[model samples]
Target: MSEIMENPKGGCVLAGINSVLSAIHRTCPVYHSGPGCCMQTTAADQGQSGHKHSCFVSGVSIPSSNMLEKEVVFGGVNKLRTTIQGAVDIIDADAYFVLTGCTAGIIGDDIVSVTNEFKTKGVPVYAIETPGFAGDSSLGYEAIWNTFIDQVIEPSEEKDDKLVNIFGIVPYHDPFWSGTLEEIDRILSKLGLKVNTFFTKKQGIETIKNSSKAALNIIINPWLFKGPAKKFENKFNVPSIRFPGLFIGATDTSEFVREVGKALNLDSELVEKVIREEEEYVYNYLAQAIGVVSWKRFAVVADANNAVAFTRYLANDYSFTPVLVIISEPIYRQEDKERIIKRIENLEYANPPKILFLSDQYEINEAIRNEEKEITLLVGSSNDREVALEKDIQFINGAFPVNERLIFNRTYAGYKGSLTFTEDIYDNL
Candidate 1:
């Protein structure tokens, strides 16, 4: 059987690692070091069993054990160099991303210098300073995105007309990213705008640089896109419209199209035309499917921004009252947090649901103890699996599924996206 077939759950990565087990060779390269790097970077096929299967299937190109305790205790510049050199000697990828993991981040290793050593040897090396402990996957993405932009985008003689940049919506996090991009493409084409969706599944390196000429930028997710959005605004002066994401139904989709229409200064007739056509299809289906179900009392614990936006949407748009919500991080920028809070306060659900400002899983669990199981709707990570298991409560793991969705499959971003949100609600019925 083929390697892909052998691992029905996308187990081909094991061959990538195991090929290195015997000895580092020309075919197998790309060494990942530091604690948890191996597990965290797997885009698909996660979980302990899946990762272990992958590791056994594909061994490390250069065994990380080469970096001894002395290196950990003091620092591992030499060790990192040795690892990179070994990777260079054995693997033949065009470039290597020397990712800094939790341990390396904590110890403060100068991995840039190590990568530079290889660059001096006339090899293209990219140094990624991603400290795992810092923030959510969005933050990790920003680290890589910023690095890619800095390295690749260059000054050109002149900018092309009708260029546009696509931001937000990483494939792993949002299953519907591919479809979302396509939808965006259709809308922009109608508007007669030329566009570039950087990091499109088969995107080439040149696409990143060409983004400089985009007249406008559309950011799908506000949380992660904030970094790139700011950079694009400052560098390219491209006006950006950030869609807050709709995960309920048609009214939300109409609002999204109208908002984008206004941002582009499109005529009222055109905006209404687009909105009416899309809105009718969504409303007819969703209105029937989303008849006021009794999801009154809800509990949401998610990444800070997602938790906030979802909670607000539930309360104001859907008219469902949340019993308790735990925003996973309190230290996010005030602007982001403020938007969430403002929406919560503006809702008319009598005594509004409490939004917890803490992240301790134990504390969150304790809070949920006060609510009845049938009244609760737990949304967020699969990590909450243990919490649900212990409490005999049903929960929806909104993010971090093993196989990634091609587009924003969660159905929370656009009009159709909002309609899709009813899937879980419909299922629970």
Candidate 2:
């Protein structure tokens, strides 16, 4: 927190719109901020959503108020109203959301009022307040749900036992979010369960509208969607189960599927049958990979969710040694911090103290420096690229600020995800 370093992972709160835009299907983000603010500040971090620069929603091409000095002094409400109305006319959006940035937040613009004014125009308009000054990207990520809870959500009373809703895989922030979501969908599909991940290519406005109709909700992490999940449960009378992370590797994923099965009152025999089929393919793939992956040692420098799941998978399944596990997000909640720590300590060669929480890039690099030779692989963000390069280690990006690869529906969770992880690491090797 004290020392600064270059190109650290993550971004400000306003960048949360990137995830919102990416996951909300055909939804558009109408910025209540100044011109080019969304693109200039957050596009690179937005990385690549399949819908990039589209009129619907991407890191670029957001319909912004473009408030100039004239509007700033006189209040930008008129401009925001005009922009919202213009976006409704222009963009082919299933739903529209209004988000504010630093300028609008500081000037105290009534974005909510403007968005609500268009309510009866045969479209849904949601509003979220995201000032860069409010907090970091993680908080911004959680704020998406809060905005949903506070602003404009029409509760769905319809129930569909065959459908489920997934949360906590933040788009853009988690590079493989769309892919991971797709993989999860695939797994659930085999169980006769349809999932709505909101932002992935397959889902759209219908997913958002019918989210409350699902019999159950699955939040991938406890940290990000706690508020939204709870509010949703109360509002829609739907129950939820909180998974540790993206069901990375067999052990966790098997439990994830079974848990879903139990929640849905699915037949145990069918659930076990699905797990057996998935594991058979996974182990068969690993059979030929044993020689290559057997002795590899790795260091994980990722957010809390990836940090815990990646460490568990490497040590338990691949027999890879995890020399260091650095979680880049500061622990704000005791329960979340405790859960992550427990997950790490429960690893095969678990060292609780080695599971550190540090966001400063300088500190992360410094910690990585000491174990340079021992750690043969770096599973982290672009920030750790310099460390991996200097140490001559095999590196793979599994977190934010990734520029090396374009990730879309490429997952690292469940059986298929494990295979993709193997393929990527092997390719890197």
Candidate 3:
């Protein structure tokens, strides 16, 4: 028997796909699903993420076929085509993506064929054939990237050595994705590199279309975009470097910078100078705020990427004891879990926190409650807030499903972002 997950973080696959497509500037997603699929998917991801919604098209503003019982019984292909045409005519987007809901997928609707009809007319329409039930939001992220690799990116002889495309950071789903991408872009720009964080900086389909010209692809997650990265390299001839986790605090961020520099064979003098300046900038702020926030044994409940980053940052940089670290996402691969565990375990100052792979809210809460190690501060999503309250521990809203605060370009990553994160810790205390 399949067990029910209570308050599972993020939405279905369709929700993930919608989140990614909606994040791209001037890119619209046309849903060919049931009546409420659009709204439910929007609520599942965007609604729970720091109260930030897409300004261009999202939530109720998105175009949908709204497949009904009649359409499901017969076929939604005609309706889907009409929806795509309507979105193209009215949405003013650089590209239109047709996403299949469970209903459409179950009924075996030919969404790809319908989308191809528009494509033949030179319309920027693509079909993502993955259904909502295929997997969770993480799969949605990969599916969209795979679609881009297969359909959008073109081969180019001209390549920019200083150009790089970023992957693994899911838009809206990650809550602080925009700010994190912006921080990464700012840091890379200091090294005289052009960064393509497609979800930010008004980058749309054109950027994706020309992404093959990038010299390298940087994936910042422990285990994501594996298939797409290989496909991207094979098709575009652009190699990629994978950073194990999101870089937070000075040490990891500097390490990330140096790694990128080495990969690109950038000027060593320039790279060192940038790193030195950035470290100084972070330390200068940290020096003043010394002892402003007392360190305590903390626990983090977040996705694999954030779990690793937060665990390492708190343990190694801030010199806090991590008592428990729960990866709140369902990681299927044992290798991926091992990689994440290794990163979390190999901290500098503190003992490795007890790591658990958990997704259900009940199980997550129970694990935290039953932890033998004393946790004074909890850094987690809003879902974990009540547990923190029950434990009477200080809580920092750092992860996804962040409904407590409105986050706009506020991040806890990189040199500058680490300072902001410190301020948040202090403020909460």
- Judged by TM-score, which candidate is best? 3
Rank candidates, TM-score, best first: 3, 2, 1
lDDT against the true structure, each candidate: 0.54, 0.77, 0.92
User: How much is 360 displaced in model 3, in angstroms?
Assistant: 0.8
Residue 32 accuracy (lDDT) in model 3: 87
Each candidate's TM vs. the true structure?
A: 0.72, 0.92, 0.98
What ranges in model 2 sit over 4 Å off? 1-6, 48-55, 349-353
Evaluation by TM-score, superior candidate among 1 and 3: 3
Residue 422 deviation, candidate 2, in Å?
1.8
lDDT (tens digit, per residue) of candidate 1 on 253-287 = 45656676677676779778776776676667756
Models, CA RMSD each: 8.4, 2.5, 1.0
Tens digit per residue, CA lDDT, model 3, 97-148 = 8888999889899888888888899998998888988999999999999999
Better of 2 and 3 by lDDT: 3
